[model samples]
Target: MPKSKFNVGDKVRLNKRAPGYYGHLLQRTRTIISIFYDDEKQGNTYELGARGRGGSLGFFRSYMLSGVSPAQASKIGRPKTKRSYKRR
Candidate 1:
């Protein structure tokens, strides 16, 4: 079995360049609450939880998450919104 990239209680963030529908989790940091091995994928899946929030966010593949420091994880903010202009 493949080893898990991140262990339980570790802080992590979604990789900025991760492909798929992870836009909402782009800049948010979370803690790894659990890890599960996948036989089909031959990899591990992690469950993440945010500070001050109850319950787990969801499961993510190892490649989808990157390790981060506690300080870095604590610094949370929303992405800037893009402005739209009318055509001339």
Candidate 2:
């Protein structure tokens, strides 16, 4: 495979598979969390994420991604979650 040109905030869709995770990937556009390099640090890996639906209070990572662009998704800032009320 050739080197991927995707950036950290790229938006992507997963390539359709036969059965496993074929359609599970969210249709809504998701923000790229970050791109990771292989353990050997030779090439790179892609990490895609999005906010959970229905106020679930969490972000979700995409199992796989395709059909998108690195310039589409905006860069991510710090998380906006508030501190919990429970004490230490």
Candidate 3:
């Protein structure tokens, strides 16, 4: 796959089935705080908003950004088409 064009400050969301550390998953809208590529490490980094547990920081692979921003959330990968989706 090609590298994503997402930049810092862009809003984004996560997929329920998206992989994470320790066999866990997340599915929610979040902000893109940072993006990094580590050729030596052979991977990428994508930091997101804080988690629910006491404002814990959340980080995931760039692939987690498969979902779109809150602004375009309604028109992008929104599993529903019947109801009119609105950004929060």
Candidate 4:
């Protein structure tokens, strides 16, 4: 197992997706309620919670960056489409 970048009680935000229309993905903040890893502890995932009680869990939970900085979030993942050229 490896060290977790964030611990329980840490605050984080989901990386914003321009076409993200889900209400939950509306630039809200979440707290780390729990963290988990695979059986081999090779990969890590997080369980996020709202700021306070009476809150609900997010639909997208797994292998996501927590508390991503504005700069880092911008380029967190690969683009939806890859540019390919025909070899002639």
Q: Pick the candidate with the highest lDDT.
A: 1
- Best-to-worst ranking by lDDT: 1, 4, 3, 2
For each predicted model, how many residue pairs clash, with residues at least 3 apart or on different chains?
Answer: 0, 1, 0, 0
What is residue 28's positional error in candidate 4, in angstroms?
Answer: 0.9
List where candidate 4 sits over 4 angstroms from the true fold: 17-24, 54-56, 59-63, 66-88
Residue pairs in collision within model 3: none
Model with the higher TM-score, candidate 2 or 4: 4
lDDT of every predicted structure (CA atoms): 0.80, 0.52, 0.61, 0.63
Clashes of 3: 0
- lDDT score, candidate 3, position 50: 62
Cα deviation at 67, candidate 4, in Å, is: 1.9
User: Residue 21's C-alpha lDDT in candidate 3?
Assistant: 53
Worst 10 residues of 2 by lDDT: 54-63
Residue-by-residue lDDT tens digits, candidate 3, 1-88: 2375677777666664465552433555567667777676667777776643434246667655575735543456647657886999
Per-residue lDDT over 1-88 for candidate 4, one digit per residue giving the tens place of the 0 to 100 score:
5687777777677765323655565477777787777665466667777667757565333435446544454555788688988989
Q: Give residue 25's error in model 3 in angstroms.
A: 7.5
RMSD of each: 11.1, 16.2, 10.8, 11.9
Indicate which candidate wins on TM-score.
Answer: 1
- Regions of candidate 3 where Cα sits further than 4 Å from its true position: 1-4, 20-25, 51-56, 72-88
lDDT of 4: 0.63
